[model samples]
Target: MHRDFAFIQTAPDRVFIGWGPFEQSPMRKPGRPAFYIADFFLDDPHPWRHPAEWEELTFDALADRAGDAPAPKIEWERMTLADFQPIFDSARAAMRRGDFNKIVPVQFENGHLVERTDLWPWLFRRLAQLPSGMSAYGYSYQNHGLAGATPEMLFASDGRGYRTMALAGTRPADRASELLRDPKELREHRMVVDDIIRRLAPFGNIEVETIRILELPGIAHLATPIRFEEIGIERMSFVEMVRRLHPTAALGMSPRTEAGERWLREADRGVKRRTHGAPFGLEVADHRALALVAIRNVQWHGDAIRVGAGAGLLPESQLEREFDELREKREQVKALLGLRASVAIEA
Candidate 1:
């Protein structure tokens, strides 16, 4: 029987791969490693799974072994401003009502695979080619799964302490430097940084690094690295820490309180977010864990595929520019999936 498979880039050159006829549990088993996969809302209580087999290898070795198989062709129905305008309007109204200083609304491009294609080769090839600072990750179970190269780390730990980042504020890669002076982008970034600091403050002494630009294929984001040290952060359960910070202002609402949850419930658009912008993580040793924010990825169920991209909506956000930002992000995701290439597997 074919089992579920997942992989995460553990270092610049290293990747961890896991095969699962998994044992599910509400939390990580003592002295054992597990993968943590959850939806955007962190809805699953039993999100931890112990895989039957796992291994770590340098990405070059994986790429050398991944045969050259053509990627699938996809017929995508791109999203338009009209499709997302209503969600933007709803978020704006909530902001005006003081429900949130900022919120992220997502748009998706739905597609259909044109042929029967094996995704493993395409996925590993892309992983091997990822630029520095980006992590390649994927999880597939049966006919449904998601995969992407993401620059945002939700959090990472190794027993003694933890490290995370404030990743928000985006611009086209060409205008990356403008992020330093763009008032709206700067404001959005500060909200993410401040909110993360607030959440992690209770667990340890915090150190924040100067903000920098994280440039990817077609877009860039302002990112600030943060560390929590010497306050016994190990005492706090990993999942509890995830709960406290999963949807930091970067991908959720600002202020890190109950209000954000309430607003999310009220503005529910009935679209399932699946694993987009959720926490996808792994732990191979006790007290050592790594979690990546599941973004810049393509998700599929059977022959249907969806690419989702989200934009931060501030009171000052304009519909036209936000719409364009969504397009930029979607394009980056396509590039990562090799969907932007001219080659395809014939139906």
Candidate 2:
């Protein structure tokens, strides 16, 4: 018999599952490293229970569903540049000030439309469909209702062993088989790899791979895979490392605290209070957990979809090119939404 779980209805559409203690069964099963749970909030004008009540739900009830489930497939749609220029320009200025290196700006094309009944199942199904050799993975945050896929690994540890990546830079990719070999892009990627190596050395004897280029469905990235053996540290304690490395150079420059503050001042203007600021459902064990910078993401607002995208800017980066890149990224979502580019006409 399949395990039956009880979920606390937090909001009309949102349900909260209480997983047992953080220490129990931390590492996911092999080949099942990624996990997710979608909480749907029911539509109600008046609030129900206080937010604190939802935290009591336990995982003893939530179990993996059985059966061969198919992944949720996203249909491709076409979009254009004129629809995503303003946000790109804002990111460009941040880059010039050394506040951030890359900001994944996104936009919404259609309103909030959930094609799946459950988010966790949908996420696993999607992961199973990823082509082999695709090392990085990501998901949508329950609170924010945003989705993202990243090919970057900060670090993975299981007591004695660990692995991480330095991923940066980008190039356009039109086909799955194509490779990227751009020197300028490689240099940008190397900067991140170098930083991670230096910071992580004291904890372990680190090994670095020669920089290589990686391609995604829409872009190419320069990446360096890494491995290490812990010197004397316990496994679970390494969660701190993960926290320290977050919002990596791929997202912004070092001295991240100050940079993040500046970014909030500049880019967050008029932005709604949503889930983009934090990880959706994060848990750490044996020093194992994965999180991604909330970039190239979108949120559902009723029947309207909002997309976000952004670009990296160095002192030498061009504003026009930065703007164009963001526009290009947003087009991906627009195309997926089946909306005409003409709808972006200036009001």
- The per-prediction tally of clashing pairs is 0, 31
RMSD of every candidate to native, in Å, equals 2.7, 9.5
lDDT of 1: 0.83
TM-score of 1: 0.94
What TM-score fits each model? 0.94, 0.59
Candidate 2 C-alpha lDDT tens digits along 1-347: 11222122222222243332121233333322223222111112221111211232222222234223343333323334554556556666766666655554433333333343333444333333333234322222233234443355455453476667777776566532332454445556666776676666777788888877676555666778888676775652333554455545665454354765555444445554233323223332222444334444445432345655545555455555655555566654344332223434222
Model 2 residue 268 lDDT score: 47
Candidate 1, 115-176: lDDT as tens digits = 85767677777779888878988887998878888999998984577788999999999999
Specify the highest-TM-score model's number: 1
> lDDT of each prediction vs. the true structure?
0.83, 0.45
Instruction: Point to the candidate with the largest lDDT.
Output: 1
